[model samples]
Target: MQSRRSRTSISISQQRMLSHSMTGLSLEQQKMLYYVGVDVGTGSARACIIDSMGNILSLAERPIQRQQLKPNFITQSSQEIWQSVCHCVKSVVRDSGVPSEKIHGIGFDATCSLVVVEEKSNKEVAVGPDFSNTDQNIILWMDHRAIEETAEINATGDKCLKYVGGQMSVEMEIPKIKWLKGHLPDNKFAECKFFDLADYLTFKASGKETRSFCSTACKQGLLPVGVEGSTEGWSRDFFHQIGLDELVEDDYRRIGGSVKNDNKGKNFLSAGEFIGAIDESVAEELGLSNHCVVGSGVIDAYAGWVGTVAARTDVSLPALAKSDREKVGIDRATGRLAAVAGTSTCHIAMSRDPVFVDGVWGPYRDVMANKFWCAEGGQSCTGALLAHVLTTHPAYTELSQLADAASVSKFDYLNSRLESLAHQNKARSVVHLAKHLFFYGDYHGNRSPIADSSMRAAIIGQSMDNSIDDLALMYLGACEFIAQQTRQIVEKMTVSGHNLSTIFMSGGQCRNGLLMRLLADCTGLPIVIPRYIDAAVVFGSALLGAVASESFDKSGAKSAISASRKSSIAGDLSQHNPKNSLAKFGGIGGDDLPSPYTAPSATASTSQIATVGFPFPAPDDVQEEQFDEDEESGSELNFKAQSKWKKDMEDRMKGRSSDNGDTMWNVMYTMTGSGKVVQPCAESHPDRVLLNTKYKIFLDMADTQRKYRQMVDAVE
Candidate 1:
């Protein structure tokens, strides 16, 4: 089973003998270069290097270890996490000297964790029997050792456990492959392989044993449900009801019969052939360039959500632009949920439909937004419950020695000692003693609603004065118990269908602005905030290496090989799927649709298109840079005009009026505003698109808004 280029053929034959002792150097020749991303978390193993305008240029890390043995077993060592992912990809190409044949495409992301891989003859075995057999295999993503095989696959109430929200999660990989086929039944023929630490690091870099629907639907619950047609793969009667029915024999070849494809699909392979070379024995032990292109893998939070939403062009030009200028609803398949928040919090989201959201795990497909369907759900501990309410209180080492003699950081000297003991107070009166300190949060147990890993933690408003002002009101009630457990999974993903509007946030408790205004006053919405916060996962892994090197159409032309061929494009359409509706615009009913479950712009005339809603005060003085290591230093992406902040978002919704008797119909009848607006009746597309100005501002609103202000002051 050794193949990621013959088990990293000594780093691609010692970087092809150092690229024939360095030939033709035009400053290390570049037509296009660098894109590696590897991730593997839950205790380190990173690698970044990015370029092609999404920027990063260098980064590395190693760690991994994780043992525990009892108190609910944990183990790891797929040969010590692939030798700590080849010592963090040979220390991020020896601290980015750049010339690994000018690196092209390579991606990877991890921590859905579960690698085992066994079949070796010429070498490599031991997934562990302890006693330093040393090959140590791998299990970790907080390994619980399948708590009774995840309560016997949730006692088979299975309808694929209602697409994961119904529960099975002993943190996935079908309860760690039914606790390794019922305790290693003689090492079950030393199980050829299983993988998921980003499909065992793209089967250890391109010996390509494929499998990433972001690791078969977030750690093998695998359900795309439907995007088109639907021969729903991976489910041999739900893996013979969790016994893993020998991974449906032959064709599955022990988990990797193929299906990797990143951006669009098919074996499209281009981070330009892993920026060509490297793996010639990992290019003679990381000197690099056995032909450089090592890409097509992702998972470290979908390569940090494609390097933190590739420096916003409404979220990286609708996912790395130029597919005839891609744009559709929810910015082409909803993403935003992000969250990250340090010391545990993931959340995520993304949708082009498949939604299963119960307690949330995922519909997964395309991992981090390609064709869509992600899900996720987090809070295994929000900033470890604000460092367990400031280091288990009792005035945490005297408020960390008066915040280390005022060099600040006991949460900035406890917010300057609650702003000098609230001298006429207001951070909303210290967030109302953080609503009487109630945090029952099962510490590290309840992963998603109640995937309960030994239900432990409990705190509920204690007392008898342990001052430092009761540890600053129990650290603002553990940051409002991590924003009321992410507003109880946004009220269970709005009853499991999801139409959620805003919340983007990032890690390190999003550098706490009173914990991002108490998660925007406990999820009432509006959070966006990514004007480049330490490269959101390295600009979402350098926009997946500029969409695997087509480099946003400056004509390198490949665009990650989108697999087509099934188009006979029929339409009598009505199966009625307005994509899991919460309708912020998605329609198709007909005969001026006002019902048949509303849409065709929810009933039409929309001034043949010219809309605009609340656009007020648009300019925030643009200038948000951070494209490090220079691909011409970031943000020049105007993508062909529209600014003056896109025509002041069309004169702030046509200079708002309804002649004072205000209602604006409960702010356009809330689904969080901007409710009815849909366009694309196609008079050659863009006439100031926002679905043709939200269907000509709701057909110049005569049904009210006071007969659209006397039909716009009788056409002015």
Candidate 2:
């Protein structure tokens, strides 16, 4: 069979002629630039088309195939995912009625899974346990089959481990690569070329093998050249210690080549930086214009951060000034946390200077934005945990039937049941319904503050109840457990100097009001919901495309390219002082290194480095005048204004109903894509005492589990 590239080939002169014809169009037509964003999540591939002002015009989705060969092992097909992406893009462009030539740029974001392909033919290589199914070339991000390899990497105590919180996670690419190398045949391993899923998507679009800094620095063990006093991008000594020294041969060709010595001329791009035009054959196959450029890609969660962090909010929060709400400059981003909650929850915080937090996955420099360091903490499972709890209950079938009969979602039905229970028991709030129950929600494992993957869930105060009321209580307990864990994570981050005061959330979970309320009340911080919750990640990718297109000058697109180039250049380590580095746990001297099994405690004397080049703007800076006059006119509308608007709208729409009627707030969200802000209950609220008590119990549950583990080990 002939390849798709050969079948859809177009001559170079035809492409040039097509490009020249666009200049003859009317001025208004030339100004109407559009962008496409494709997101490859675990279960599906989604695409969206957005105009210059960030309004999503059309969206589409298609489910991809996944295989579970064994427990804790998940695999996928790269070809099938690519097909889904193409179909979704085609559908969105057709539905939106946008001309192909008017689409100026495209961007991609995907799970940080690993992909293996033949170096010469670019054919898929088998990664399954049987090693015979070549279509299953992708190793999912959630696969825990590399547990032993993770332990081995952590045991080496290499200096590179410090950047990943002094431990390696099985979820990262290195451990997964190690597992493949040890299990696959030597011939198959030698012929393999590895790419992160996001990079793979880029390569599929542009036919360029350029890797992204976001993928290399965060998941793979590549030390960014200028940050952390490193002269070369890849640490050869660390690779040698990890027994994967073959990867260092040929300038690390198996992976993306090293930054300083890339023989293949492959560039490592930052998020939204340009990566050449899309391949002509690929553009034809996907029903796009050949003139469209492809932007560098990012992990899905990082895309969520990009989508939600720079939202134009009405309130002046602790993180950003009123003028800076539309821009995510380094200084303004420090006080905000981007919690991209879905099947799992990833908490991303940025800082002007590197702030090392124990058990967090970063302090990785120049990954998300230029001159900024990102620290990532996460929960291994949140939505999955809730699903497990709800599905395993005896009343689940009855609950589903009732929800269908009422034309409501199961979660909404459960929320109503909990409210009724609260009323019947005369409880202060729904939180008080689970007063006697306590849950430890590490069913998958702890991803932060402990960094232990061997931990399991523990529940107390069970009474063998099998009724719907009992199910509601259990669900409430699980939600509370998620919130309590968030509190612990925030405490860890704040103690290490993050200073987070508000959470900007995006994903499917943001639609769940009960979870949002619990998150705010539990953490005592306000939550900022994005305008588009389920589509935020894909919208973020579209933002990346917009930045690459450079149609809007306010996005700082040119500066981003310059900063990435400067960071990638060799002999540029003057800004990073060796004494201030956290490579040795705050640069402590001697053999006093902490154990590899436990997270190192942050010391009071931890180094604080000054921000280089990008200084914090002054309060009275004149640059604030550069904003559009219309934006500045009504920019002072705070949370109080939003609340009043909501109330007035509710009163106006009273007793009116529609097919889409769920709540007045949701109706408001649909009509105007204006997001909602959820604030914590007052300090004197009736449930405060019970919540505090439950939080204490939540803290103790982890310690109790550790003691149980110790007892079991002692007996053996």
Candidate 3:
């Protein structure tokens, strides 16, 4: 095909002339008005036009191309991504009819991937010849080109690796760069520039090669500075052992020199200062902003988390009154858990102190919206798991044909058939049976707790029936699996000091009512599905711009409000009435204490509730002696209460402790990179089974033999 530019240049030129005509206006009319936020995802790129109010005026999208080289080697052209970004910006601005001079700021968020650029004398060169001159730099985020390098790095047992979930994923740039060095040494020598995709976007827009701490902290193994006792940004001994010592350049030039904390007060580089006012020369070519600010960007998932997590709501009803801002699901509290469920699901929770969970990624300080430490746990295929569950069934082909004939989706058809069957079975206790046909979902390998990528999926029970009745059960099972996995994460986190009260869910999957209901029933916690699941990333980027402008600090609001407003904001989406909307799993009940995150099944014989956090007895749960309020008035309430409680408990336990010989103790373990595992003390519980899920134990025959011996002795 002929080049698009070679053919579309004339119209682009005319559009450029029209854009510049506004600069001729008077000085008073010259306003530092709007800002643009660009978000690039796996399949496409999007640009948003927003004024100072955080309203999204107009947004545009342009699809980018991806090529799978080898089985695991995924590649993309830096040129293609840059062009798509520019195209989107121009489209949104043109479609909005907003004056170019009015756009004062710009921000970007993209997938965190490696970009490889070769040096010829000094200028960066393309990786290959096909579209070499125009587009041969970026390595896509999903690309697993460095699996071997990642394994090798992990083998080093580097202290720095602990910051990123004990294992260094091949998806990061360091491993990819290492792969390039060993596999393509000639290219490695010729290469002068390497960047995370987000950094690359900023470089393309503002002519700067700076890196953000968000990228380095999460992906590039940057040993955090100011933590006291850390020598360099990375561990020098660790890097030298990994055979890529050169990555730690003296001036930090190859990746970045300066770190721009967007949360701190840092203005985005003005349009003119970087890309030269998006002038006629460029405007006639790409048809973009002349006065718009082009901003430094962030990873895509981080952007999504930023947009929707913190919002001040005015819902005055008592139903939402139980919503504690200090709770995990509400915006008023810090350290709340927000799970973004899409093709995959990212579970994010922040903390005041860095608490590292064994298999979960991060202790990433200041990475997510800043101020607090972030811990990210996720399921690799959340929505994708649901898709796989529906599509691979034997009845899928017939269902597809029937749905096509009816001009509706297979899911819609399946739901209709399911509802009809449920109506017919209304007299029977079929819904009870439906709940038992549970799905133990590990379909896409476990992303957290188990981090076992090679583990295959299993279905506990499946009938040969291909009717819609079977579909409803199968669908319910899928939702249950999602909730179950989340429960496991909550269990582990609670043990380590996270007090989760609610789950804030966002993403397209939150639209699935059956899934949402199952989540409620399974987790037993109130699920807050944000009004705007799709446009969260844009809101997040706009918030970043607002923070940079000192808006949050000035208002004492803690969260920044966007300057430009979108057509319809994300927070305004309403829950669809199920009478007309799709059939869901479960729903909102009366304002009681929202079900616990892991509640026991009502039908199950065991009355035990799956309480999180080390399964310890709460102080209040224990019997305490009563004290006269007037007599204890001189003493503090807490101290006096504790004193009386301790005396009463001691007297009660005098003979019980000696007779039972059962003790409840807490054991805390912290894994260090030096291969020294510290267990302060090991506690034995007689009343319950104490299994430390934090450590890896092999189930091989020899290990089984050892465990059997311990079990037998414990029982004795």
Candidate 4:
């Protein structure tokens, strides 16, 4: 394939002629904007180049090395991971043939693993039991070595724990940090500075220690600046109570800064907010432009949410006027969950208000969107469980041979085998083929709605037969377990206040047709797959890059207003008198919020939005005037009412400075994209009934385990 630059290459004379011909266009219009998104997963680092419209231009991936030092203790070399990142990034840029100068921004997302660096040496520090290997500095997210610390922290019952689903997991940064302090030599622990892997990538790129709200809020337990009834951002008392007062005493320098102390110099940016320009040396190494800015990074799962949550859905509401379609979209978004499935599955759901689901991590403020709260529920082992079941089964070699012979993957062959078994058994569906099999896949422990790391898996109804058919049955059971747990999680979320109606799924799991179908049937929710299934998380990072680009910040309001003016409704309003149309609708005014009618000025900085006591509008009232719509006489009254509401909000915020704040209003441009919808099978009612019965048994299994533990303890 010809490279993009090779195909578009032109001589100086042709360039001059082309430049002269394009003189009528603005600089922004003449240049094609591109962004690079890099995603560091548990097994590989993937990168992609995307146009401004969210289309993937070129992609590259490189494998990352991991070492399992012991059971539940996994480690990786940050140096090696960075090398893989650089390699993938450079490959994407070279393969795409897009000029480095044209790549306006770059963003990164990674597994929420912990990276340890020595403050003095600026080098990797050993995180594994082997102190000699400094290269193994990253504690993989699946590492559960912090189980004791997690239990100790949870025992304190600190008020801060409420924000993190009433208990911190061994997977979170706090417990891991505590584990390091207790286990590592005092001098080594004192010398370390910890970073969530995502923040580490951004810090490496920008040469800045700025942390992302997605990382700090979701993983590090930083109270978002704007949560109601909270004045201080970090809970110093909680930190002290948890026996990690050194962090508080040091003003959180090792992690991030104290949110309460302005002197700490720790900057926390939300997702898509600009961090800084890439470091010159790093830029050269990655083959990117020095001018390219870096965006605030997100945990890989949140990046999955960023990539898929804003997808256009087919649902339309008659009650909402055409002008209120943006409102409708927001409503739809709140009802849709983004299930980023891979080695583990993270179910991310947003709500207009905080929804505190027990065992689910969050009510995290301003992580995904500016005002919306996000809840994350997860299963610690899904993909890994399937892999384990297949790779360990006696008939695994037979299954692999058959799959390879048929020119299909093992999963594909298993899915086909399950379908054939259902047909042979005259079952209602493939789901019925596993009716007698039950798998409680907590092999790595449950991450959410249970928050237990000590839990174990229980498989019932296994046969003595060691055949390919038996292996297929085991795979089906594991898939069913994953889907049923999803249903349990959704139920927990719904009970807690989130009204999830659809599942926007991303990551490698999206390619599993069996799992996808099972997820929909088991959850009874339609699953929407993104355009690039495996690349969705990276694409989301690219969207972040597009948002952070200088062109986006400078021309955002102009583009919004221009697009609004082209709308039939705005056109009709302009027909009466074009010059004063905006004034007529009360759009021409000084406002505290990021509105389409006003361009951001120097006085309005992004930081001001984080100030204590700023009266941000209620979530429902945000961005009502920003989206454009078609004209409809029947909706004129509704538009007028919205205009009145906007004017009221402006009056309320009149004295506030319109300075810098990273708001989602500017993100509208990058949010429009396409996806494939996987609706629930219409004929799966009988399967649904069978699954519902198994789901009841699934719930009972957890309770029975607890009872068994109690009985065993009492005897002791």
| Model 2 ranges with Cα > 4 A deviation | 1-30, 261-266, 314-319, 322-330, 551-674
lDDT (Cα) of model 1: 0.50
Which rank order by TM-score, best down to worst?
4, 2, 3, 1
- Scanning candidate 2 in windows of ten residues, the lowest lDDT window is 580-589
List, residue by residue over 1-716, the lDDT tens digit for candidate 3. Answer: 32222111112112222232355654322322355677777778888765433445677778888776556666777777778888888887887666754554466777777777653332444432223433555667666667778889889988777777787766677887777676553444435667777766766664445466567777787754543245445566776798876665664556564233232322212111111122223433335443333334567776665554443222222323354422321133344577777677877776667787876777776454333467777777778887887787776677778889989766667666666666787723223445335355665455676665544455657878886567656865666567667767766677777666556666666555556654554444556554344655654554444332221112211111122211211111111111100001011111112212111221122222221111111112211223333432332223333334323322322221110000000000000000000111113321011112111111132234446657888999
> In candidate 3, what residue range of length 10 has the lowest lDDT sum?
664-673
* Pairs of residues at least 3 apart in sequence or in different chains that clash in candidate 2: none
The alpha-carbon lDDT assigned to residue 498 of candidate 3 equals: 66
TM-score list, all predictions: 0.29, 0.79, 0.66, 0.80
lDDT of 2 by residue, 1-716 (tens): 32222211222212222332365655433334578999998899999987643567889999998899899889999999999999999999999877887786798999999999999999999997758998899999999999999999999987778888888889999999888888997567888899999999999998879888889888997777776566667888878888888788898888887775332233676677666667767988789866576878999988888777644344444544542444322344566788998889999987778888899988887676555678899999998999999999999999999999999988889999999998998987898878889988799988987899988898898888899899988899999999989989999989988878788888878767898899988888888787677888898787777555542111221221122222111111122222111111111111111222111211111242221221111112112112222332242323343334323322332332211111111111111123457778876776665777788998888988888899999999
Q: Candidate 2: RMSD over Cα atoms?
A: 16.9
- The clash count for each model shown is 61, 0, 23, 8
Q: How close to the true structure is residue 456 of candidate 4, measured as C-alpha lDDT? A: 85
